[model samples]
Target: MTSLSKGDKAPEFHGLNQNNETISLETFKGKKIILYFYPKDNTPGCTAESCNLNDNYQAWLAKGYEVVGVSPDSVASHKKFADKFQFGFNLIADTEKEILQAYGVWGEKSMYGKKYMGVMRTTFVINESGIIEDIFEKVDTKNHTDQIIKALDIK
Candidate 1:
């Protein structure tokens, strides 16, 4: 679990998006950010979560929020995934796990009696000034937007 909590200063990060464009916290300095970290690209849970956010892209934008995804997947994989889903948001390719480590989302995991290091699916809702407003450690993949909206009481 992440040591980060609401009201803490969000860690600054910079990574390449699917388009290979450099993006950083500074890029969205004046906007609320929904920063999500997932395990991989094209996986079932990740896909569902990503698509849910994509489907509500317009609503998020209208609500003054920007969605960004981060995964250990490479830039090429992110490009393919985003292109296939036609996502309007940015998917950061954190191939080096720099951003993941900064957010404390990259860590050990156990599945089927096997232990491995991987991403812990998590989301951070950061306010305009780079303060974390909410942290979602247990995400509802298929209905994530609703989860965030309900948690934040967004009208």
Candidate 2:
């Protein structure tokens, strides 16, 4: 649902991570960023996606990429989720949905004919300069890391 596309400047944002520490796009300046947005914490699909990424986090770091996840869940929720899974990356708590809206990932969604506003699952591969190198709208939750590597053609 995001209007942002590849080659666009990724929107700047600042929010509290699961630890309640402030995290901002500025914090990752000059580093390739894997910025991902998800709907909630502790859900099946979200858990699978997050675990897959966390499982391969070291490989991502070795490749010079930092992973960050954003969700509308509260800081407490994020903390629990991250702690339970022992995630090695920052999980930003977008409780106010500010980051979500800025990235255009917050929008109306439907489930079983019921429509509601929620965060749309998305990932933006940002370059060292903060430019979006690729956008993944249709994520493969169980194999997201491999999906990203293949999509970016990373060797």
Candidate 3:
């Protein structure tokens, strides 16, 4: 798997959003993108990060950017998570894990010495030109969306 990093052309794919509508990076061409890959939906830290972004969504819009959350979850689960948390952005249902793997966020993770494979909780910031400008390989779930906005200076 090619490690997604700064200067890499953001891997593009067409997938279903929370509503089961198909979308791709091509759809958001000419705009900055926040492609956040978390482990799951409706979980404690994931929900908080998503909700934080939703709370500060207008600021992000004013700065002209789009947020897309991806995980191995299904569309139905994403819909429920979005509805429950009023997530204003698109939650991608990457059931095949293609997107996650493409971004190199799917790998072995160990928790308490029990090694297991799972989503690596990573985030990528693709610029309007479709170049990956920033990559947060290990993200702090608490208030992490703010970190993205700050790192990108989305004022």
Candidate 4:
């Protein structure tokens, strides 16, 4: 799969959120979207990343941005995770791997000599006009909010 680049146009996607509400990329037009894809829900890295974003979510909105987390987990799983963590944003359930494949965030991952297919902890910042403004592939979930804020040029 071709890795998504800085200028690559983010693929369009229509999926259900934790509430089972159908959402499409078009619905978020004219807004800054922080699209972060993680491997799973409730896991250490994923939890830390989501919590950090939740912790600093106001800063992002003040800069005219919205966040939409995506993962291969089911909507129920996403709901439990979000409810448990008190997240303030939508979690797109990409269980079919459609969005994951299109974004190139889903692929082979290695852990202790075992290879498995999963999300790569990649994030893309899409501008209001739908162009990808930046990408952070080397995500450190513990300090991800700072990284995203810096990438978006927010003070």
Model 3 spans with C-alpha error above 4 angstroms: none
Flag regions of model 1 displaced more than 4 Å.
none
Model 4 error, position 154 (Å): 1.5
Query: lDDT of each structure?
Result: 0.97, 0.97, 0.86, 0.89
Query: 69-151 in candidate 4: lDDT tens per residue?
Result: 99999999999999999998889999999999998888888999999988888889998888888888899899998887676
**Deviation from native of the Cα of residue 142 in model 3, angstroms:** 2.5
Tens digit of per-residue lDDT, candidate 3, span 51-70: 88788777777888788899
Kindly indicate the candidate among 3 and 4 with the higher lDDT. 4
TM-score of every model? 0.99, 0.99, 0.93, 0.95
Better of 1 and 2 by lDDT: 1
Could you tell me which residue pairs clash in candidate 3?
none
Candidate 1 lDDT over residue span 1-155, tens digit each: 89899999999999999999999999999999999999999999999999999999999999999999999999999999999999999999998899999999999999999999999999999999999999999999999999999999999
lDDT of 2 by residue, 87-109 (tens): 99999999889999999999999
The ten-residue window of minimal lDDT in model 1 covers 93-102
RMSD of 1: 0.4
